[model samples]
Every structure is written in structure tokens, then in C-alpha cells.
Target chain A: MKQLGLSVREDAVGNIFGRWVGSEAELGAVATGSHVDAIPFSGKYDGVVGVLGALEAISVLQRSGFQPKRSLEVIMFTSEEPTRFGISCLGSRLMAGSEELVRSLKRTVDNHNVSFVDAADSAGYKIHPDDLHNVFLNQDAYFAFIELHIEQGPILEKEGIPIGIVTAIAAPASIKVEFEGNGGHAGAVLMPARNDAGLAAAELALAVEKYVLESGSIDTVGTVGILQLHPGAINSIPSKSHLEIDVRDIDEKRRNYVIEKVHKSAIDISKIRGVELSEFKIINQDPPALSDKSVINAMEFAAKQLGLEYKLMISRAYHDSLFMAREYHQWV
Target chain B: MKQLGLSVREDAVGNIFGRWVGSEAELGAVATGSHVDAIPFSGKYDGVVGVLGALEAISVLQRSGFQPKRSLEVIMFTSEEPTRFGISCLGSRLMAGSEELVRSLKRTVDNHNVSFVDAADSAGYKIHPDDLHNVFLNQDAYFAFIELHIEQGPILEKEGIPIGIVTAIAAPASIKVEFEGNGGHAGAVLMPARNDAGLAAAELALAVEKYVLESGSIDTVGTVGILQLHPGAINSIPSKSHLEIDVRDIDEKRRNYVIEKVHKSAIDISKIRGVELSEFKIINQDPPALSDKSVINAMEFAAKQLGLEYKLMISRAYHDSLFMAREYHQWV
Candidate 1:
């Protein structure tokens, strides 16, 4: 509550930080929780739900006269959409002790002109890489970290569950495959003589689909979401094809199996179609984070007291918690 | 021959006509012909061989001081490559009374800035709908038309044949098919939920190849020379695919069968892929032409007199003679 001598700080990039001073014994200590700034129109609950839910929980604790072991802080990060700077979870990723991703984000969408430094500066935010440490200092003082989110998929709703207790967030790997073939006049050429890179790519794509379907890895799956053919003329043979493969699983081993099959299928298709195929692993092996059992027990105990029906479920989507959990392994 | 006082006249497009003066007793004239342009980097023998061969035959007759019952004329038409003007045998087609084909040729390659009038002017030719008859004049003057052309295929050389008398030339039907689908983020979407236009196109192309091979028409064949995926991106689904189908046969019915199968297959693929697909028949049908047996006999007689061996063979490629033969159907 503002009556507790609360104050707020606003950064140049519109990053807002609000604090509620704890008792004198807990002063100079910190506990942090917050959400991102924006979401698309369709994603009404994404970041907004997390920030509002945390604030509501804090208010309830205040109303009940409950006190924490350490100073409790609620924070909202900025530019989490990555829509503006091409860097999703920019605020959290930076707070988790890595600025390396910022370098790569600078070259996003094939544009190298806008560096991460420029993006920050353009948004009127200071580019002090050293100051990033301040964001993590509170992590050590926090007694616990928690995030409340809407179940984006149908699993919880289908089961008629009102709330979900998070267990593990599934990891994903994104792969890009490109095939190169000779471009030539289509009419005068014979099929037997063609390298036909597009055909090769198609065969591989279909094989990937069939492989995933037949593999029956209950915990893993693969999908082809992007396909491109180059020098696409109605009368000229296609010279190149690019395809994207997205495979994910809570079980890393099964995900690896799907990826290996995809690569093998691509190689076989290239050989059969007489074209050269190459594979590029863009996002490799982000392992799933298993939630802390102690936190789950505490949440279940609280749910019982509140008479709220909840179920344990796996997080199929990635979130900022995955990175924060990396810093506090037991919290995950 | 040059010594025989031959007079020449040319149209605006440089289609040359040569007439040799003869005695009044010879009421009709015999025409020997061919075009003189080559395909890009083609062998010199392709077009020039036909013209030079006919000229050599006439030269030998002139040296022998032989006189025929009819006056003989040699002619050379222009723009046979379809490279500069995008239409093959334009001069001959015009001369053979195909005004519709001329109009269709003008419509080729849509969105092209060059108008038909501008294209004619740029090519040093003028097309006036009223003056179309001028190009097709003097139709009854020809007693017979004999054309000499090199075999485009290697069948004659492989069989060690010395010469071949023309029988019929094969006709080809070229068709263009395009499939449109929704393009969206690939990773965030599922296959069953996608319309995947490019995938539908790929299936149709492969089906065409399979159907043509299975049609059991020994001489009937089909090819997909061009396959294009539009707005091709590595992580975005394809929204459109354009395909070119070239089906050919000595028999018109068989070619039509292949074309029909292609259309049916495309429709079926569109339905299966959950995308909208449509086709544009860019090039329709042109029936094969049968050369005149009387003219073949005359050529054979001349070859026999020169102690040369010859065999009758069908032409698998198109030539100006095809249209010319149609024009002089009675004599051809």
C-alpha cells in the first residue's frame, strides 16, 4: 500500500519499478516479482494477468496483516514483446546475467544497422552494461519467486480445471533446412535430368511430417511451418528451397530423436532428388525447467485453504521464468 | 539463283520474299523455304541448315541448266526464336492467317509495360488489323512447297540415316497452374490447421509426372519446367505457388488427356490441402501438321537422282513448315 511509504522509479525506456518498504529489520533487502509491458490485442492475458495477479496477491497479504521474511518487491519489465526491438523477453533476459543475446538480437530480421546499443539509446534508455548487475542483486535476497499465468492451451480447460500448478516448461529446438539446385529452362528439360531442389525440399518436409506422426513419441512432436522456393518463375525451374522445422518435447531425448530423423530425411531426399541440401540448427537444446517441489507443495496447501481447484500441469510454452529459474535453480 | 534475276520484297518486320522470273508457260510457282534465326547459343545447323540446304539443291539444279514446269522461289521469314518477341514463328503464323494467335501472343507475360503496338514498332514491323490480308496474299500461286530442315532430335544420327523426308510435326500444349494458400507464422501454427499452398502445388507437380509416366501413351509426355513459391521466407508459410506444365504428343487426343489429368490432379490437391487453387491455360492446343506426300515424293525423286539415300520420319518439334503446310493443305 502507498501508505507504507511506497515509491516508484521510472527509467528512460519507460521501465517502471514500484517498491513497498518493509519493516526496518527487512530494509535494504529485496524480493522481486513483476511482468512485461505489452502484448498483442489477441493476447489479453499474457503480461497483464501476471502483473495484476501479483499485485492482487500482495494486496491480500497486506489486508491479512501478513509479513514476509524479507522485503517484498513487485516489478514490471519493459519491451517484453520484442515487437519493437526484435528481442523477446529483452528486460528479463538482460536481468538474468546475459547481454550476449542482445548482440544477436541487434542483427534480427537481417538488419545489422540497428545494434542493441542503438535500440536502447533510441528508446532513451542508458546503455550501461555494468548496471545490469543491479537487476540481479535482489534475486539473492528473495525468499521465493513465483509467476501466475493463464493456461494458453486447451489442456487445462479441457480438463475443466480452474487453476494450474506449473511443473516443467518444455524445451524446443528450431531448425532451418535449405536445398540448392540448378536453375534452367523447364520446358526443354527432362525430369530425369533435373536436380529440382523444390521437389527435394518437399519430399523432406513430407517425410518430416510422416516421421513425427508415426514416431508416436507421446511427449514429442515436429512441424514444418515455413517453405520457400527461390527464383520462383512459372516457367523456370526452382533453384532453391528453404524450410523451417520446429520440434519440441518435455523429454529432451525424444526431441533429439525427432531432430535427427529430420536431418536424415533431408539428406536422403537430397540424394534421391539429386540436389544439395543443408541444415542449420538455429535454436538448439533449451532443456525444460522442472518446478520446485517445495513451492508446488506450498501452493497446493494454500489452494486447499482457499478452496480453489487446481491441477499439476506441464508448461508447453516458454516464459521469462525459464531464464529466472536458471539463476535460482531450486526455484524452477 | 542470283544469275536468274530473282526479285525480292520485304515486309516491315523483315520477312523476305524472293521470286524468280520464269517463262509464261509456267502459270504457278513452287516455294522452297525455312527461317534463319537460332535459339540462344544453339547449334548453327538448327535454322540455317534448312535454308542453306534448300539453296544448295536449287543451285545444283541451276548449274545443271535444268528447267522445271513451275517457277521456284526461295523465302526466309524472321523472328523464329521467340526470344526477342516472345512468340515463335510469328512471321509464319501471320502469313498462315492466325490473327487470333497473334493477338494471344501480344497478351503473353502479363503486366509487361510494352504494348503490342510498341512491340511491333520496336521490331520494325507494323500490325494493322485491316492490312492482315496483305501478308496472306498470292495463296494460289504455289504449286507445291518443299522445306528442308535438320532433325532436332538425334534419332536420325543414332540410326546412321543419311536424310529424312518429313511426315508430321508434333504439337505441344503448355499450361500454367497457380495455387494460393494462407501465409502465416509456421512455428506457431499446426499442419492440419494450415492451407499450405506450396505443398499442394508440389503434390500436383509430382502427380503430373506420375500420371504422364503411367498414361501408357508411348509418345505422350509431360513436364513441369517451372515451380515457384511466392513471398518465400524461411519462417513464413507459403501463400502462393505457380507451376508450368508442358505436355506434348504427336496425337492431339493424347495430349489433351494429359492436360485433363493435370487439371483434375490440381483440383484434387487443392481440396486435400485445404487451399484454393486455380489454373490459367496460357498456351492452348495446336494440332500437328502432316507434310504433303507429293512434295515428299518430289524431294525423294531429287535425292534418288543425286544417288542419296533417304527415309521418311516424323518431326517431333515445331517449325514454320507446320503452319505453311496448313496454309497449303491441298498441295501439302
Candidate 2:
């Protein structure tokens, strides 16, 4: 554990991992977790809270002069936000041996001109392809890996709970929709003749809202977070529009239905308005993670011992634990 | 006419008049033509065709060695396009002693900043008020005034005829409507939470189209030619929107109804979107003109003498004849 100086050992594509050693050297380790990176201008509580809070918990245990049969280690993962490296949870995804995603993040966010190699070097990281073998080397050695995170949705707050034991992390699929139409002078044109891109985009956005409302499913949620219009002048007819759709659901079927509805609405609006429409599903299937039943039981048992109120809830936000579970399915 | 060189004598507002001496100089003159100035961008045949064509007829008479008992004069009024100096047929209106209209035109577009006297100087014309008085002084001496003009509408064309004798000019009321809404971020704010100035403006625009469609009246037409949205970013929820509504009709009640519908739609949309909305009306009313029955008879008789296909039709587009008839009351 002490061989790497707690310095990151990255893979060929710049997946980074930093390990800390614990007092119990002979027994296999127990991993305590959190991601180190953040979103742009993000509140300190988001990912940092879990990372720092885990460190404090370990420090508290160590200061009390207690030595466990298994060693405890803290991990600081690299590039979780996709802000700097154009990928979310790259470190965890790689550690979990997900080859499909490992290659996909490389080509994403093309406009940023960020190559995987450049991102690693710029962040003072070094990659070693041999180290990837380590991911599969010690599956049985680790007792269990645990992660703490802030519930990003209102479910916990609405339920009047201070802490929640996540049952499963909801899968998120980000979709990009673009509408294209002819641009011209607004004054000289008649309404019936216009193939207005902005109007088409607006109709699609409203349709998404309508779909979600009519579906009457609490688990399904949709958001059109970013909308960009080309030649966006009030006096000029819009020529093109770009929008991002963030859709999520605890159940994959419901999420797929919502996405399918959005796609159909875009096509319908485009046909009605004589506009060309295209949609790219950037995130197709983010598999939801059912929290390790053993982990949930452990948390409940600990909460009872500490006299803390805790409830089991689904995690609306994605986390590294999902990938970890998929990697070591039997262990989870 | 001699005082103004070989050219005809025009009044202070540039209305042209030519007089030919008779065998007995004491005899009164007969005016046999209409104004020379044309409507804005109108066909050359509207007013000028009649005046010049009549002059050619007069030349033919002179060449044939024919002499009338009385002298003949041709007249042309100025500012027929509602020139910078004043409103429709300002020369005829002034000659007819409609001082109230002159004052209104002066105050309206000119705002008294450029008085008619100053406007004349700017146009390189010099005239004394005394000279203007002399021009109108001999109005009672005229035996009769007649006019010729090509009908401006398609009634003649639809009937497969070539010429039209004027019956009446339809009244036109031009109206302008302006709509004013708050702008914000489209992402952070939900559609249900947005005031969405652009959407409200669009609702009003569509309402205008619907009103024109449902009214089912041929005389009434509405146009939304100018629309402006402030800070018009696709990602921005528009804060303010301005739209120009132009409504015109021969019937004042129909015109008022269209304007009223547009106004009500704006208010309704504003309330629905939870935004502040205000409107400004620019243009109000212009009355119709009925052509002189004698003038129509003269034109029809002339067409019959020449064996030309002719029909009586009303003028859809407004003309100086409107104000001329309003002022002179008997000129048409």
C-alpha cells in the first residue's frame, strides 16, 4: 500500500487512482471512498463533502487508538465532473473495467480539443498501461467499498430525513436534439410560410413537458437544460436550434419511454413546421445500481447503534458505487 | 403661367396649373384635368396618365384647328403622397380652405419643427402668402373642373375590360399596435415560471392572423410587419417584445374590430404569461371619397365616343381624391 506514495497510478487512457495505506498490513483492505473533482463553480458540499467527510471519519477512528483486522484506505479519483476531461466518473468507470465507456469519453466534448493524454499531463497525471491489470488483480482481497454522497434530489428533503441509505442510483441518459430551418427576414415573411427553428424547438420543449405531465409517473423526470439558437435575432427568423435533454428514471423502461416520446415529439414538430430535426443520444444506457443489500443492512445496523434516524431511498444522482457494483457483481 | 416662365404656375405646396389664353381674354376658364402628383409608388397611369393623356387630346384639338368658346386650364395638386409638407392633396385642401386639416398635418408628422413655410424653402421653392391668395382668388371664375383617372383595383381586369370610370374611392383606416413583456434564463426558469415575452408576442401575432381569417370580410386586412424582442438570445427568456400591427379597411367598424381583437389578445397573453404588457396605437382614421356623378358621366361619354371598353369601379387604395372631395365637397 505504501509503494506508490499515495500518488496517482493512471492507465493508458489516463484513468487515475491514488491509494493510502492503513495499519493492518497483512489482511486485505476495506476501501472508503469519494471523488476528488467538482463541477464548475459547484458548491463545496457536492462531491467534496463525501471525500473530506470520509477522511475525517477515518481520522476519528485512528485517533481513538483502534486497529481493525482489515486495513482501511481513502481514494481520490480523477475527473468526475467532465468539466476538465470531458468525462464523468472516468476513474471509477475505468477501475470497474468498463471498456465501452472507457473509449467513449475520449471522443466526447470535441470542441474542447481535449485529448486524453493532454488532459492527464495538464492535470499532472502519468499513465501506466500495466497498472490496469491491478483493477482485476485484487477483487477478493477487498472486504467492501463504501461511498458517501449528498442526495442531489428533493426526495430526502421532502421525506423530512437527515440521512438516507441509497437503495439504487437512478440511471441518467443525456440526449441532444437539434432543429434546423431556413432563416429569413421576419417582416417580409408570412407566418404560414415560415419554418421557424426557434418555434419548432419551443414546441418540442413544451411537448416534453406535456409528456412527462401526462405520464403521471413520479420516477420519470425530464429537463431541457441548454438551448442554443443560431442567428438568434428577434427580427430574424431562427435558422437552427440546439437543446440538451437530461432524462432520468429509477426504472430503465420508464426512462426509455420518456426518451422515445421526446424523439417522436421532435419529429412531429419538425414535420408540422417543415423543419429538419435530428437527435443524438449521448448517453444511451446508464445502468441503475441497486445498493448492496449487505451495505444497506450494515448502514441500518450502524445507525441503530448510533441512535441516528435513517431511511432507505433510491439515489436520483449517479455515483461511483454503481460502476463498482457492476464490476464486482458477486461481491456486491 | 407666364410668371413662372414657360413652365406651369404651381401653388406654394407645388400644385401645378396651366392656363391658355382665349380669343376673349375676359372669359372664364374651364379646368379639364386632375392632379399631376401620384400616390406613393403607384402605377404611372393613376393620376399622371389622365392629366398627360388629356393634354395630348387637347393638342389634337388644337392641331385640328378647333377653338373653344372659353379658355382651358389643366390642374395638378401637390403632396398627394402625404409629403413631408402635409397630408393628402395639401394644395387642393388648402385651396379649398380646409385650414383645420392643414394645421393637423403640420402638427402630426412635422410637429411644427418644419413648418410648411420652412419646408417650401428647403425644397428650393419661394412663394408669398399674397401669391397663394391670388391663386385661389379666381376660383369662382372657373366654368367647371373635371378629372380623369385609371381605376386602381382589379374589378375591371376581372370583368375582362380595359378602362374604368371612377364611381367612389373606399375609405382607409390605418392602425398600428405595439406590445411590450421581462427576460430571464431559460434553463434555471421553467416554462410554467416564465413570463416569456416572445411567446406572448407570438400569441398576439397569431391572434391577428386568426382575426383576419375569421372576420371573412374582403375589405379588411391585417399585417404584423415589425417585431422586436429585447436581448433576444435563445437561452434567454425574452424580457420585452414590440410588435407593429397594421390594419386597414374601407369599413371603419371592421377596422376597429381587428384592432380591438389584437389589443384584447395581447392583454390575454400577458395575463397568461404573468408579464406586464402595454400597447400604442399609431394611426387612426381616413374617410372615403365619392366621385362626382358628373365626372363619371363625362368619363363614360368620352369612352363611348372613343369606342373604348369601360366599367365603373371603386378605388380600393386611398388617394388625394379622398381629401380633395372632403375639402371641396363637390369636386368629385
Candidate 3:
């Protein structure tokens, strides 16, 4: 931002913004930005491409002697990944004025037991609990929001496409389920006498696949990404098993239906296996977002002028754009 | 042993023996003993009852002024549980002249990475690599061995039996299997594109249950006691999954057959799921032990003389007696 000679500012929740003032600066700004936060063991291209790509775009535009009518802002949203607080798109969720999320922010803690408020405060963003509305952006805060991100999937590569214009972002829901049973010595416990929680979890994991496939949509996908068996030893029958499940789809209703089916299957599996379904929690369920018509038209027109081949595709992996779409009408 | 004025000695691998001298000390000793080591989170009575019960039996014989031509001995074996070195009945296995096991003992390390030899030496039982045979008992060292152990299962209690005469012990096989697949963002990866290792492991776990039940014997049992998914995050598809399986049966051939079925199923699941079966290791498989007819008859005669109700039963949970039966002609 300094090299591009833009005025810089940061929001209360540590969302960094660099604005290039235009002749009509009073009008709603045109924003192009993305998060820099990343998950562990992830590739470098995920969020880095968007953040650096926006800056590069600004540099290129300035070198071309182009001046915008509306102020152009580049934002680096805070905590886009759930790696720290077990919640994604934290900054944008606040900016979108999600009341329930804002109310629960102070109570949220990381795996290390550090509260979200304290972490933000220590990072120089002092959060005011009662006055959290300051972080929320008003209607028409941005004339348009466009993020430049690398495709996170293999679809484009498989089709030998050079570029993809995301038309819609997928909805995602996270669930945690745990089953408990009476554990004993593996050798001492007979097959008929054992109520194994691990087997119950296995049954549920397979059921998640079964239900998602039953949905009959390639856009719909589900994963039992984390499976843990308690007292995990070779000779000890598992007394409890915990699973973290992720389900997503471009269709909100379809995703929710799959989630409901998973819950029913979990209950049925526990009862039949004689294990207790101790917990089945839905951590978050955000609705899908569509790209604005004007934004899609403008991007396609630009691609055509550049003589670049581009495919319009739905984004199964979501981003800060998913939450920002809630606040701004023109978001892609 | 000191209170009873008997000679006490410990072997090279920490097998403690207390011998009550009789009229003919050179005669083969009538031995009765068990291990006191236990796995974590276990009840107090699994191995403890056998050790204490042996001492109580000695006390009762002394009080009755019983005189025998052969000496009576109580031996407390070391490291019966695989809690430390991943090998059960260590002392008894050595005593049974398991040359293959003894050869690997020096290299065996606990979870803390402390070698078995170092652990034994630190406990005041120094071992000599070439002279490991000192720990092996002679074939005729014991005239007869009768271990008084508490039933580890519910069968005796369900039948309200006061005494159970051991007829046979189950053979157990431990297997460690690992599967690997390409991991990616859960949402980004399409259902058809995913070769999920976690799902492969789940299929194998369910297969273990299916095959064990198909064995057509109540004595046959199998368990997937340990399962782990690598880089286990809710939004990350599992790239790797590890499982530790346990299979057991009173009949060795039946147990081995079930293990073969499980292995075949594992390969089939991996191939079908497009995940690599990176590891499929049989850690250990030991033959089953059966009590001598003479020892069972002697126990039955004693119970009948005392007017006690007794039932002949199979021991599903292996112990030091399982290995000790390998060296001695008469073991119960």
C-alpha cells in the first residue's frame, strides 16, 4: 500500500484498508481485497494470491495512468481462517452486522483457551463489547466488491482452462458428534457384549457419504474430516468416539437437508449400536451467496477485451466474499 | 515370602519366585503364579486377583500343615501387560523359550523410547544378550502349574458359578494398518474426485465386525481398538488414516482365518477407494493354550471335595499362563 501511495487505515477488528482517493471520493468506494490468514499445512496460493494480487492490480492500474471515479480500497480481512478461533471470516462477519456472531465473539475461545476479545486486544484492536456496532458497515458502504483469488479446486486444471470467474460461493455447515459406550479390555470384551463407540462413529461416517450421494448433486459434498477414538490403544476397546463433520453445497436447502439426514442417521446408529449419542452440535451454517449481475457482466467484458478464455464457475470453497456479500449488494 | 520363612529369588528378567522347601527339594516344584502388571484405566482385579489369590492359597496350605514331597512355588511374572514395551507376558514369554521374542527384546522400546534392556537393567535385573537363555525355564522345571485367576468376562458371573476350571486360552493377533490418499480442502474436492483414507479405514472397521460375526462362533471376537486421522481438521480431507486391530479366538485356526479375511477386506477397500495401503503389519500372533487334562481333573477333584460348584470354561483373555503352557506339560 505504501509503495502504491494510497492512504491506509485499519478497522477496530484489524481489517486493514488502503484507499486510492478518486475525483468522486464521497461516493461509495469500489473495494478489491481478500484475507491473508491461512490454515496449517495449506498451500501458499489460497489467500496470499488474493491479497498480493489486489496490490499488484493497483500497481498495474497506476502505471497505466488510470484514475477511478469512486475510491478504490484494498482490504486485508482479519482471521479469515478458523485456525485460531474455530470461526471463519471473523472480520467480514462483524462488518456484515451478524448480531448473533457479534454477541458471541467475546465468549469465543481458541484451543489454547485464549478468549477472542483478549487476543484481538493484545493485537492492538481493543474491542468494546457494548459498542461492537462500530465495526458494522452501513448499507451502500461499497459500490462494488471484487476479490481476485486462485481456484482452490482441480476443475479448471482438468478442463485446461486458464481462468475462472466465480459466479456463486457455496454454503458450508460444520457439525461435531460424539458417541460414548462402555469400554473394556479388547480381549475380554466379546463381540455380542461390546457396545463400541468407534464402530458407531464409523457407521456415521459412512452414513454421511451415503446421505450426500443420495442428494444426487455433484455440487453437494460432505466429509467426516476428523475422527477420534478415546483411550486409543491397541488392546483397549474404545469407550468414546468424536467426529468433526463438514458439509457444503451451492444450494442452501440441499445442504440443510443433507445435514438433517446426517443427524437422523447419527441418532439411528447410536440407538442400534447401543452407544450413547452424547453430543451432536452444529457449529455454523452460513447461506450461499451469488455474484451480482453487473459485476459478472463487467468482469466478462474485461476478459473479452483481453482475449482471455475464462469459465464462469461456482466456488465450492468459500472466502471472505461469502460474508461480505451479506453487507454489500454488488459483491463477487 | 519372608513372613512364610521361604526362599525368595528373582530371575534375570525379574520373575520373582518364592519357594517353600519340602522333604525332597530336588523334585520338580509345583508352581502357581500370575502377573501383577496391568493396563491403564483398568479395574483392580484383572491381574491382581491371581497374584494375591496364589499367596492366599499358600497361606491356607501352610495353615493346614500340608507336607509335600515336591516344593511349592509362587512366581510373580514381570511386564504381563503391553503397557510399556508393546509386548505382553514378557517374562513368561522369555521363560517359555520364545527365542524370536528374546532376540527382539533388546531393541524393543516403550512409548517413551526407553529400550526394554535398559528398563530391565535399571530395575536391578541386568540382562546379558548371549545368556538370555538363563531366563528360560527348563521343560521339567515345574511338576504342575495352576494359576488362580479371576474371570475377566461375564460368563461365570452370569451363571453364578463359584469356581471355573480353565480348559483353554484364546490366541490373539495384533495388526497395524495405515492408508494414505490425496488430501485437499473438503469443500473444494468433489465427491467423485476424493480418495478419502478416513472412509477407507471406516470401511475396514465395519468389515472387521462383519467378518468376525461371520466366523459362526461366540468365542471369536474382533475389535478396531485404535483409529487416527492425520492432520485432522474439520475442513481438511483426511490424507492418512491409521488403525490398530485386535482379533482373538479360542481356536488358533479360526482366529487366523478371521485375520486373513480382515486383511483381504482391507486390501479390497483400499483398492476400491483408490487409497494406498501404506502399511499392513501383523505385529504379533501367538498360538492358543489349552490346560492339561490332569490339571483340570485335579482342580475338579479339589472343588468337589470342598463341595464347591465349578464350571469348566475357556479363557478369552490371554495371560502369563498362556505362554507358561508352552514350556510346561501341565499348566492350568
Among these predictions, the greatest lDDT belongs to: 3
Q: Pick the candidate with the highest TM-score.
A: 3
lDDT of 3 by residue, B1-332 (tens): 77876699988888899999989988889998888877767778877787788888889899999987899998898888876666778889889998888778858887579988788789876788766788888888888888887777778888899898989998988888999999889899999999999999999999999999999998888988889997787888999999989899988899899999999998999899999999998878999988999999998998999999999988888888988888888989
Pairs of residues at least 3 apart in sequence or in different chains that clash in candidate 2: B181-B239, B182-B239, B183-B239, B292-B332
Model 3: which residue pairs collide?
none
Cα lDDT of candidate 1 equals 0.66
Q: What is the full ranking by DockQ, best candidate first?
A: 3, 1, 2
Off by over 4 Å in 3: A1-37, A54-75, A83-86, A102-143, A301-308, B1-37, B51-79, B83-86, B102-150, B159-163, B294-310
Q: Write the residue-wise lDDT of candidate 2 on B71-144 in tens digits.
A: 77767766654434325456665666654554454445353577666567678877554455533424455555
Best by DockQ: 3
**lDDT string, candidate 1, A216-332, tens digits:** 755555555556666554334567877766666788877788778888888888888878876555544566788888888888998999999999877765566766666664442
Fraction of true contacts kept, per model? 0.15, 0.01, 0.68
lDDT of 2 by residue, A142-249 (tens): 667777887755455677888888777777666667888876433233345567776676666666666765667666655554455655432345677776665667
Candidate 1 vs candidate 2: the DockQ winner is 1
For residue A102, give model 3's deviation from the true position in Å: 4.5
